[model samples]
Target chain A: MAVNELGDHLRQGHPLPCGRLVEDVFDDLDRGRIDDHGRTCVHCATARRSLTTLMEATRALVDDPAEPPPNLLDRIMQAVRAEGRRGEALPLVPIDDTGAAVVPDLGPVDISRQAVAAVVRYAADTVDGVRARSCRVTVDDADVGALRIEMTLSLRYGAGPANELVETVRARIGSALHGQVGVRAGAVDLEIVDVWPEEGP
Target chain B: MTTPDLDHIGGHPGDGPGDDRLVTQIRVAEVAAAAARSTPGVAHLQQGLWGLVQQLGAEAWTRVTGRPRPDTAGTEVAVRVDPVTGAVTVTVDVMLVVDGRRPAAVVAGDVQRRIGGAVYAAFGVAPGRVSVHITDVAVPG
Candidate 1:
């Protein structure tokens, strides 16, 4: 039965050894398990190598104590507040022409496409090394209240790696919209419009 | 609950009796833009690349036709009025100079507050919505 299971595993990629077996092999808790897999299967060998690489990368990250940019916290807080204000101030336009229309006493809450765009633009601009050029925030007509935010940004040259900067902007905008504006960003699309030239030394 | 009287408040003077003059949407936008521009820490308003293109196009048209450009063509203010309630909403996009000292959020808030006040003062109706966008931060000299 064990041989048949191994054959099935090799053929169908079904039910490989339990995670415990992989952990045991890596931790050296069961040398016999490693020997069992090391002798015949190439899949286990590949898994072991991949796991080892992941562990090394995690350790390297843990060992690095590089401090975040000093303005990160301020930028994030400002962005949250700015975006929140935009969300709260969305205008309530009258949909119908009823003379006796009862304007809900919601006390000045407004929402519009431009308001959403402003919120997204402000949030993206708050990221260090990122300058938002234009932002277009659209609502999904089919799925009412769903938001799609698109932004064009000019990243500061030499501020940081481009990928890291983009990731930070994405994470910040998502979190700000969720936490501050009480809206789930369905899609956040970023375009690098330009790379700002660094000042002369 | 009592509804506030919207007509009794100040409005534009129309041609005939019982006809209330509606405030032009451009006027509302202009008020908001002036308010924002006057706020401290707001260095200057950015026309943006698109605005620049429009301006150049307008200039070319004017030069060829020898006609003055329309006032509404290049205005930065965008205003929308509710057809039923006559409520005005304004949106302004601006760039501020932070000088690395004050927070951008605070400057933006101040601008928003000032814009609301200006619109209210001009039209006697609270703006239904005021949206401010901070596009760029200028370094202080």
Candidate 2:
């Protein structure tokens, strides 16, 4: 079987009946019979590791007595409170300088109004045929963390290349968020927002 | 003596071939390209063209250098379920075939976005994440 196919099976977590397929693909890799192909097999390796860990956890759970561990509810509640505390205390901000604006130090500014503005400003300036009119960043606070940023840009074309400008803007914004804000900027919605030809009044 | 053509010596043929994640990934890429093309504003229709371009380049390089062709395109896609989170992660290799004039990153992002959308449509479960790898570029002959 192709390594890729084996990898697929592994990724799918489909059980391979014990044999060459299992022993060669999954077990051997676990046992360190990993060949060149085996070494390169990211899929098999990940699946094997995950499966092994799960199996170990399951075994530990089953080995325990019939009665559940005491203080289970307490432990659960404790975990929940701990998580809440963690969320409350955002960890992204390493240094809380009073002078600096604290835009939710939760590991990269969730694509917010500020983040969008920053991206638009950087992108529009770098690109030849573009300028920003207004930028709006939508913050969706739900089960999933991070806000949905929507930016509207007003563009004016310069004599230079058009594509480069857009490309530069996208790259700059993407890089800034990655480098400075440390948050994953969801979608850099470039509305064209509005386009003004250079010759226009 | 030449090999006999009567019947090939092999194990159970009925067992059939195993599934290939790379091929599946390529197929997924194709599906994605098709989906993007179907979408209102998409302008290109080269499904998995990047893979082919890379394949061509590797083949050319091998012939010119008289060296064995290193397998340049080895990628796989797998959909796995997380036992703990129950979320699904669809991991695949994405070949980006950019027109020489176009930016590579733009093509890469488009492929990634389109493929993500296609996967979501194919599988009921939305993938926790989609990772794309660009293998090659396609320039006209």
Candidate 3:
């Protein structure tokens, strides 16, 4: 029988390993042998083309060489050192466990403070004229998930009025924390440790 | 209905239907957390009040022991998976240092989109819901 005929037979009655076979055909580790049927079948041919495109895109990304910003490593290391100073073993708060019905072997659902800090840092870094030197976050043990945040910032002189800057920071922080983490920031304290001169206009 | 044979699927194990493979909640959370951190307008992730206490304690401990601080701390991630549909939901609380030039809402939306895309790419499962809580924002120098 022709390859197309064989593919038709597989589709009609024989099990042709739908998604799995397509994946195996592309995987480097286990490039499953595809008979002539796979080469001729329309569905498999389309899937193969897609997989090829994906692989090419991935290869291009791997080959790209992008330079990182100055002091990026130093800043990252500083953050790491700060975390070490803070210690490990982040606390995890449990969420609902009703998922046990669907997944018989489900584990506890919990969020960690370390994760929260990372998000805070990212949000703070985006503000203009504000460079986050360090951040300390606290979650209230109360029934309400209230947050107390303290950030040390290096500000640029003449970025904006100090009061305006503070207000903008407060609003952005409140919105980001609530939107991303589903937590409320009860209070945010910003300390300006240093002011740097601005660059060219 | 005929069950799909999962063993033939490539990539991670539990990614297929009816395969004894399992994706841990922590792993999913990490993916979400990484996505959030990568979003623009974010400064750093903060550990809440308890985190503050821990830092103070660490300071005291460092003063006494004179040992170097460890870099083990980062953002936290929490994941919830639906048993029926296998959908995942993620909630993240973050502190941002936004550009004084951009609107806060715009940055927040970007973070949300990035997190959703990252989760889908990593797990082949689109996040059912992604919630972001902004705790603080600052102007970057």
Candidate 4:
């Protein structure tokens, strides 16, 4: 405790890892001087290197930093925000008594809901004249691994969800889910939002 | 970045005397993250909906700057070390983006297996649960 107090006493605002203020280090760097402590401390060395890099970057930015492409700028910020949005966990195997799909020193596997949805979406996209919009693969409350897939899609402008077409899509989605994920889907509910006219003249 | 929460203070089912080897969350996460990142058909870690947007920009940057993007995988690992015995158990989570060349579900399974295998190989203990999330399906144009 006494040592901490002593270090704090010597510290400037917001001490670095070595109990020395980086601002002091910055000052020393500005004047092209490093004290005995700076010469010996690794943290100070790192800070000095960082300060040097920052100075270089600042000069570079001020000198020539120009406007980033508008589209690219928008995409970067969107990625920053959307990266954290993920779906719920869907167990790949049966959950035991503890509600964890594990075998005490063995295997326990789970995949995200979005992964299953992606499987459904990719499958739906394979159907002719169909564009998949979104999907949700929810676990059945009564069954361990059973899933119900709810999907939305837009049919081609001139096309319709004919009985034959719907059956084909259902079969395709079921096969994709079973083959890709190795789990049987309980129900595949396809809801066509509307007709898309992308291919129209 | 969520991992299984286990009581490490004491009385954990896995905790007992004579277990001396220590394993940390950081180490498991490192190993698991490496394995997941190396798997094929992973454009990068998950960034939901049209990850193609971000991938396009990143690819352009790499093309211009000649520096590959660093640290793409975000593996969440939680470790519980028994205070008394130093025994450890872990749970690892990873989210990835499918590059549209391979099936997402298959890739996800492979990720889970790889992380679980890598952690066990590194620490001689398996993760309690290895959760894989897929945020984007970047179908190639």
* The best candidate in terms of lDDT: 4
DockQ for candidate 2, please give it: 0.02
Order the candidate numbers by TM-score, best to worst: 4, 3, 1, 2
- Measured against the true two-chain complex, the DockQ scores of the candidates, in the order shown, are 0.01, 0.02, 0.03, 0.12
Worst 10 residues of 4 chain A by lDDT: A94-103
C-alpha-based local distance difference test score of model 2: 0.41
Instruction: State which candidate, 1 or 4, has the greater TM-score.
Output: 4
List the candidates ranked by lDDT, beginning with the highest.
Answer: 4, 1, 3, 2
Across B36-124, the per-residue lDDT of candidate 1 in tens digits comes to 67776666544433344444544544444454443332134444434456454444444323222233344455666676678677666
Off by over 4 Å in 2: A1-201, B1-75, B135-141
Candidate 1 per-residue lDDT over residues A1-201, each given as its tens digit:
323433443454222222224444455422434566554444355445545654655465566465654774664454344343333333222111222212332122233345445556667778888988888766645545446777888998998999899888888777655433435566778889899888787
RMSD vs true structure, all candidates: 29.5, 20.9, 18.8, 12.5
Best by TM-score: 4
Candidate 2 vs candidate 3: the TM-score winner is 3
Top of the candidates by DockQ: 4
Candidate 4 stretches greater than 4 Å from native: A1-84, A87-89, A94-115, A131-136, A141-144, A152-161, A191-201, B1-27, B47-72, B99-106, B123-125
Q: Which ten residues in a row have the lowest lDDT in candidate 3 chain A?
A: A99-108
RMSD of 1: 29.5
- Write one digit per residue (lDDT tens) for candidate 2, span B89-120: 45554322223233333333444455566766
List the global CA lDDT of all models. 0.51, 0.41, 0.50, 0.61
